[model samples]
Target: GGSASSGQVSRGGGGSCAFGGMGGGGRGVYAPTHVRSPLSPQQVTAEIKRAQSVVEVLRVHKRFRSAFNYIHLSATWNVLGRLAARAPAWLQQHAASAGALREDTHRLLCELDAQGLSNVAHGMAKARVTSRDMWAASW
Candidate 1:
């Protein structure tokens, strides 16, 4: 424990636990923290549209590897899932077609699989389906 008072057993064998020497209070462990604000419906839609545009550009250039690396398609699907979970009903109703999104995700996975990144491809594939299911169930 970071604090002198912490980790000391009381008369009744009771003591408080401090996390990662935090209670000692002197220059305790410092780690950077990330705070993400929720995306507005417009922001979410714009991001999805951006991802779609990247996919199209990759297709045009036949740059599958760059697409995989630069676009982080797996993360895009994750963001989409989060949007589905948090988007308002009106937004969801007006959102892009789920089937098209699923198809695009499958296409990306197939490209990754062709490049011998089957592990990443499989993981993204599962994530796509899981997110879709979660979105559906949320409705």
Candidate 2:
């Protein structure tokens, strides 16, 4: 089973991430190296709010994507858009994060508000994730 060795981030069970190529290869769901306990939605939101850098936001983003519900989804997109604007270069460097956000956005599109839709558009534009699926999903 794969584990987070030498500061690498490990992906959980039944999930794939580009962060370290460590996904279902593990025996079971691999908790991320940083998370000691499961984080609540409020905590995840606070973490996003408190984040000062792209890396910080991205580190917890997967967790947030999984944990967020209808009420928090809009703020999530808004924060992601703000983060994209603040660190466009970092967003490019960590493009996988954007992809995850895009996939989740598509899956949860019906749950988002108008502001969330706008923020998703703004953030995806900032990340240059202009794929046909994204366009189709928007319409």
C-alpha lDDT score of every prediction, in listed order: 0.34, 0.53
For TM-score, the strongest prediction is 2
Candidate 1: where is the Cα deviation over 4 Å?
Answer: 1-72, 88-96, 113-139
Backbone clash total, candidate 2: 0
Q: Tens digit of lDDT per residue, candidate 1, span 25-117?
A: 222221112133255434433444464333342332232222222124444544444433333342234334444443444433322212223
Give me candidate 2's TM-score against the actual structure: 0.53
- List pairs with backbone clashes in candidate 2: none
Each prediction's RMSD to truth: 17.8, 11.7
Each model's TM-score, in the order given? 0.28, 0.53
Tell how far residue 71 is off in model 1, in angstroms.
3.0
lDDT of 2 by residue, 20-127 (tens): 223332322233343343776577668777766667767767666655443344455556656666666664577687567656554444433445556666765664
